[model samples]
Target: MSAPSRIVPLLAEGVLAVEGTAAPSLSAGAAQPLPAPGRYLVEPLPEAPLTVTLDERSVTIRPGGWSGELGPSRGGRVTGRARDDLDPGRDVTVLALATGGVVARATARAADGGRFTLDLPATVARAPYRTRLTIGIAGSDHVLGRVDAGRPPRAWGPAPEAPRLRIKISTPNLREAPLWGDSHFAASLAAAFERLGRPVGVDCMDAWYGRTAPEDAVLVIRGRQPVQLDPGKINLMWLISHPDRVEDAEYAQYDRVFVASDIYAAHLKDRGLPHVEVLHQATDAVLFGGVAPPETRRSAPVFVGNSRREYRTMVKWCVEQGVPLDLYGGGWDGVLPPGYLRAPSVANRDLPALYAAHGLLLNDHWDSMRDNGFLSNRLFDGSATGTPILTDPVAGLEAVFGDTIATASEPEAFAEIIRSCLDDPTPFLARAARAREIVLGAHTFDHRAATLAAAVDRIAAG
Candidate 1:
């Protein structure tokens, strides 16, 4: 019988063709019969080759060699074009991998025609690194592509050796969308460690709830309500907003306790956890930097917080007082009055801009825990965005934001504060801008990481 026809396209450079029926068995010496199942193995190819196998019938090979270099260098350019068929809206994340695992990841938005270019960090070590791209599409799973980084060794000398600080976050997940208030804190902390060049591990304490032991630093961000601690480990508890007051005996197990506000720190001190420190919550500015437009200055007034009973009450009071408030966040649905504008939970990247979009931002503490000294994430977020904040008069609020935040003790006072913000906005705006400059300059993730690393170094030295 005649051999099945050779159904795959055999093209010279730049030629294109649709595939046909199955290719015939190779005569003794055809280019080692393009691997079985028609999958092209182009490692030997000078450039990565693109081969398409047609419906089990044939294969078409397009030989525009792939240049595997990933990302740009300090003085060099990292450039590449993605096929138009790739998802456009999704971010194309390029990960640089070393023998140890992913050393860095850079994300780029696909151009109108699906092209992408990224500026890679120059500090990466000179080693055999691989690059992989992942595209996360809405309503679908992420798609990935792999390429061999084709660049030569960087001329920079060997990377400096730094002490490795490993931080483990006991939480549900580390995604940008947090299920609870503490989840947001945990995610931010983990991201901070990563930014500081520390290897961070996030494990669901709910999965390993009671299993606790002395670790490098096992940070528990609101895992339990009463602030349970493990006597065996150097446990650090990060009380996101507030927690039920624990007995003195129970609070002694924590080596370090971090509270978002001085009120909470005072609560911890009152409860006998004297080692507590007031580390104001911070926005992931790297993420928020993506949200607000660079050219747009603060415009609308806004409020961000949980849409719980207390929050809804505040929203209603604002509406009753005829205040126009732009609301952005989840859970405040039925609670916000009819006239309020609701923005979906702002993306981390968009938060800075979101804060920047509003002239004034409001922060309200839970009425039940008002005396407990809790400052919500909104305080930090608003302050970070240089948006003046109008909040409940709390002990630490004034200290942290100073003149940037105006506080009111009652609903009527709150409304008046909002009016004042509207009537004479310059002073508040200037204060907010100064506050933002302070936090961005000194309280950023990098700063926090440096602090944590120094603490870890001290511990190690001892």
Candidate 2:
């Protein structure tokens, strides 16, 4: 007997099969109606690589060679495919320009899938700097663009004076492991401001305590306990961790407040704090993308984080369950049965490869953050490596990650999920790809830098 005629959906509605071929019927759920019967080539769309043009000169973006150049004006037009594997309807691309102490950025989303344009502020200081340009869906590893101006542009009359937006960021010393996150976060924010043509200074909390900074500067503090800074400047408290630790009375001291999680913002507002904005943790996409995976990744699950009670519980459960887990973080000594941690601690820069070198990564949040939906920076870090991660479920996390991440409510579920993922790596790989696209699309440090620049501009205006 002849096999029943099978049907497959076409790329667009109203596409008709070729004459004599089976007329594939559209499902009731098909979005569009059938069009007049005619020949149609129905297939998946081809890859749409970026086509960057500078001053009417076409530049090819490749992995090893220099591609494009920007004038002192730092304005250009970019045309590329609007859709990617993640979202076929996506039409936007984010652009970031980073130089010595400066970052200029803009977004260009093509409406007609023809071309999009981006123009940076002409007043930005002219200098040679590395460019990290990323277009979502085009793939996250596009960091080869560079701007090589032989020298500064010729002076054209007297240049205009720049904006007065000097910022001084104070955080704990870099040597301290517990506070390294705060230090890295503050440094990244400072670099972003510098890219925006703002003079920024960062110091250990103790160095700036009870001391004055540059006149008319803005001071930003990132720590558990607020430290005294130059009282003369407007201080902004960047609560990176332990939102609940910030007392109600502490809210009045700073000109503005920034939290790392949107849910934390609501919690603080509920606690009567005002002028709070959510500045989610962002990964340095270029750095993470540069990390090369090891030739042999361990078959067992791996996790890279400090030894906390909750994290220890999950690790211990893995050991008891006969699953070999490699741990990387400080203070794990004597915590696990012998042979658990491959190394005492791994550098933050090495985290991406470490993540990529494993089939599965485990994550748990700080108790306060977990309860309040404050996603950890690890979430972004692991995702950037395109590695499957299993984290504890948080309320509203689906909005941020959708089905790209897996969550286990309890230790047993975590173990069970890990086993299932190990048995079939297909689903995990698929989710990792989706999550990476999301991270590159909206959660990179460039995105956070733009958000911070806008927020500072608004606050400075007043």
Candidate 3:
């Protein structure tokens, strides 16, 4: 297997259907073909973002030719040059999803997005692309493949139509940076919307330009960055994080506004942004739905998230209290003792199993988001998996989760929380079961989807 490599935005005219003839190759058609040292595809599309896969190797494309590591895109295999186009029989018309089976359209668009992510074209696409590329796998691990016989052309155009809503994700693709959460979050919600009989599709930020239909209501999962809004269609913004970056003018642009915090929604409403409503983050209960039997009495506290440069609250507390912690994420290099730092990230599809494997999960929040009263999605994810969780106290958490969640008021409280869980664990286990029931009932992505879907329906009707 080949190791991963990096590249950045290429101001490309179009996509080139290239394969890994050898290892992985990245060149500018100018950098002298990288001297053939490493195994890469090295071909230059020159004017567009290049995406390739090297066997089991992951690829990260960023700003430079290959350095920044902004995040990850889907890894692909150039295995035997995409087999010839074969329009298979429509025998597999039924899509088996978490919400049960649905007669999926013969067209190349997935109906139940929360379970089955995307449906690729049965034929090769040239341009005017509604075409979903490389990102072929679903959250449920199902894939939609096409029998493409045509080559990617160098032209582009736009289109519009049908009553539908599209989820705008921050991650460029599904198999993205291990810590990046938006794509999976969006996919979970998209499936829920489909279960309610609303047609939904997911798109990365870059795909918004030429592909978004004019009639489709756009749900922007506001996160670390901004995606441009098309005023012609019904525009909606759900401020999930980075509350400070969203200006008043931006809120004024959306027909509907959703903030993930109760206090933030109140603040917006008081500021006369009456469109704002409280829509907290959610989980896919069907996926992260069960508690697995313990492999060992492994009791080390588990925390999964990026370091974000500073020593996180939970890790800091555990360290000071002399408790062992199992950490997963990047940027914890100089701050941890040996054997404490686990893998930098777990894959999105693998998260359910990861959470299920743990005895206890610990979580914290960023100062900015925490101050804004925004709770992390892990709260929902860990709880949905029926894993006992200990987290830092925040406003509105108790109200949403009730005593189903165990929270600490300060660093000093971590000792008590940890000691109690290890000693008795019965109370915590009860809480976890209660939290799972509550989340599956009201806080799953389906619940949130129903809330937002009502608003979108009303706005679209007008």
Candidate 4:
């Protein structure tokens, strides 16, 4: 063999081409923001050599450079047909997933014809959420196919020529806070509507002064920053948080008002704003839809949220009780004891893994929200991750989540619940699975998009 061809074959398939004196100060993998964590296809050799620092520490890799690919699936039912000359009745376990979380698992057994089908649970198979398929063959030392966790492609059709009333989701979050502000909510909602073949855009508060077009309708997301009503436009509002900041003037000219809390919706309607309705916040199904296997997940409690300028109740309880916690958020500098805080903030993309790693999620709502029924979006996001959640009491919590969630008004109950989870997590894991079904099936941005889209279509017709 030639010297170049016999160079030990470090990496398979010529995937990586790195040569340098250890490229310094560069961090790859999940640690940094750039170069997202996923498989990248190398098309051609570059003229200039790439510089990268390979970690000296040992790492695990598949023996044959595993490849995982999700086959075409519809309604969570993944089917396959092949003429295998190997063995009959040798079933391959198929795992259907959304993002990285396993939503459904099925077995595809090879019959005489070598044909097989994987029927993923319809409860978790919605097109709005991305889906991946994993096939685990028996008697394999290495995970053969690992690319199902990667991405797929889809193209959109051309837009209509009519003067359509597109939507503008206006929020107080700035252009800079893509991963950490209200813009995440706005952007997800816009994408949800876009998937339904509607034109939707997101504009931060600073850009909303004189930028609206006559063909645009506004959907204001009310949080800490309250936006004023636009009288000349078809304005709809979703009052999700910061109930105390809501003002009559801010929602006066809004064509429709969707409150997060049924109680708050009534409160607004009683004040002569009869256009108000209840519409709770939802989760990003594809992004926050997966859970790690039980054996692989950690059993410690995790909390991811800011202090909101005050010591959150569940966090204080965890600290006082000496619970081993993975806390990630901001505004926790002087409040938390030394070594208790894990990170100032967890990146938006990293939240699903964070939720999957921990056994339990610690959630809370502000005083106004808890009392007035304005459920925090955290509840929805955590539930979607399939993490058993222990949240502070909120009005109608039972009605919405049923018994899937554990509510603790006092520290003692909180401790009891955590202990129970640590001791026997089977019941909690079941609850988490049920909660994930609820979120993915009904409480996703796709569900909310239908309601919001109908409202805009009505306005356009009028």
For candidate 4, write residues 58-158 as lDDT tens digits.
22222231222334545445554432223444554444323223455555455534334556554444434333333432222122222222223333233
**Which candidate leads the pack in lDDT?**
4
Over 4 Å off in model 1, which ranges?
1-177, 209-215, 226-232, 263-274, 289-299, 329-337, 341-344
Candidate 4: the clashing residue pairs are 68-146, 68-147, 68-148, 101-290, 101-291, 329-344
Best candidate according to TM-score:
3
Local error of candidate 1 at residue 422 (angstroms): 3.5
Q: Write the per-residue lDDT of candidate 3 for residues 152-206, one digit (tens) a residue.
A: 3422123233357887776755455234678778878888988988779887754
Residue-level lDDT tens digits of model 2 in 75-127? 43333332222443445343432222123333334345423444433343232
Worst 10 residues of 3 by lDDT: 76-85
Pitting candidate 2 against candidate 3, the one with the higher lDDT is: 3
lDDT of each: 0.51, 0.56, 0.60, 0.62
Better of 3 and 4 by TM-score: 3
Clashes of 1: 12
What is the TM-score of each predicted model, taking all chains together? 0.55, 0.60, 0.63, 0.62
Error of model 2, residue 398, in angstroms:
1.6
**How well does model 1 score by local distance difference test?**
0.51
